[model samples]
Target: MRILMAGVSGFLGTRLVDLLVADGHQVTRLVRRPPRGPHERQWTPSAAQLDPALVAEADAVVNLAGAGVGDRRWTDQYKQLIRSSRVDATSTLAITIAGLSEADRPEVLLNASAIGWYGNTGDRVVEEDAPPGEGFLADVARVWEAATRPAEDAGVRVVRLRTGLPLHRDGGLLKPQLLPFKLGIAGRLGSGRQWIPWISMSDWLRAVMFLLARADLSGPVNLVGPAPVTNAEFTRELARQLRRPAIIPIPGLALKAVLGGFAQEALTSTRVLPGVLNRAAFSFRLPDLPTALHAALHD
Candidate 1:
């Protein structure tokens, strides 16, 4: 399959490209800068510019484009950047795909969404059918998923990946926790009861491929492990895996002070279930928390 992908330079995107290449799929990267190679295509999402010819050439298009929500302190300006980066890029791609002739349009489009769509679920388990929840990230995700309406309207099998916290030692949610936990100073956040929907990096990529291969599946799919753990449970397991005792707890107020607007999201509880993936019989390589942590740290 010929796959055109945005966000290829990101941590997940880099691995996804490698996996796609290994599986014998031709992956073309959409770059903001000038095309540096034949495999690269220039796009300006801010200007909503994407060549229809580029969309027509691909068998599928996977968009993982977005500003890193947790990458910086969430100032008002950075928050706006987070929203525009995703909504704009997705709208650009969706509109471009919609303009392609029937015969030339790609078969499918996989756009990145997030579990934050459910907002602070507390203890409630959400499936793909769940309605949009409240909060800033939820609003962002609602608009983010809505941006793909053009492609879906054009008969493209569009799938919005409501991804969870991807666990990997090198980057993502696990990286910052590693040093603190390894030093035996880490503990749960706030009440430590907020449900966390997590997935291993391996399962994340596999699920993308799984969705790509299934023409029968479309719309929003929760990309997370079967087992959802509470923040306390997750902290304990991670600390146990590292052979360290975690006793210190960071107050919710402190987190809010440090992370700013991102703190509320961090403290938000979302127990997401992979209903779509489960019904499709998609297999998870790291289905359990222990297994996922082990693979994330050791494998």
Candidate 2:
């Protein structure tokens, strides 16, 4: 399949692109820079400008464009940026695809979303059918996923990937926590009871490929592991892996002071389950937290 992807330069995107290319799929990246090679195409999502020809030629379009949620303090302006980066890119792609003739339009569009859509799930095990939760990230995800309406209305099978916390060695949620946890200065965030839905980078990639191959699936698909662990459980497992004592607990106030609005997300308990994936019998390579941690650190 010839897949046109946005966010190819991002951490997850970089890995996904490599996997796609390795599997012999024709991958064209929509880059902001000038076209540097045959695999690159120039486009500016903020301007809503992408050549329709590019959209028409692809078998599928996977949009993973968004500003890093945890990269900086979430001020009002940064929050708007986070929302716009996703909604704008998705809207641009959806509109471009919608304008294409039926014969030329791609069969499917996989748009990136997040489990933050469910906000703080507490102890509730929520799935794709759950309504949007309250908070900033939830609102952003609602608008972000809604931006794909144009493509869906155009008869395109659109899948919104409500991704969980992906563990990876070099980058992602695991990397930042490694140094602090290794130093034994970090422990569970807040009460340590907030349930965290996590997945390994390998499982994330594989599940994405699985979703692309399954024509019958569409709409919101929770890209998470079957088992969801609490924040305390996560801390223990992480510490155990690193052979460090994790006894220091960061207070909620401290997290809020440092992470701003994103700190609330840290204290959030989203016990998510991949209902769609499980129903479809999609298997995860690293289904458990300990295994996922080991793979992220050693694999």
Best by lDDT: 1
Write out the backbone clash pairs for model 1: none
Give a tens-digit lDDT track for model 1, residues 1-299: 99999989887999999999999999999999998999999999999988888889999999999989889999999999999999999999999999989999999999999999999888888899999999999999999999999999999999999999999998888999999998888999999999999999999999999999999999999999999999999999999999999999999999998998899999999999999999999989889999999999998
Model 2 earns a TM-score of 0.99
How high is the CA lDDT of each candidate model? 0.95, 0.94
Identify the runs in model 2 with alpha carbons over 4 angstroms from their true place. Answer: none
Provide the lDDT at 170 for model 1.
89
Candidate 1 TM-score, true structure as reference: 0.99
TM-score, per-candidate, Cα-based: 0.99, 0.99
Clashing pairs in 2: none
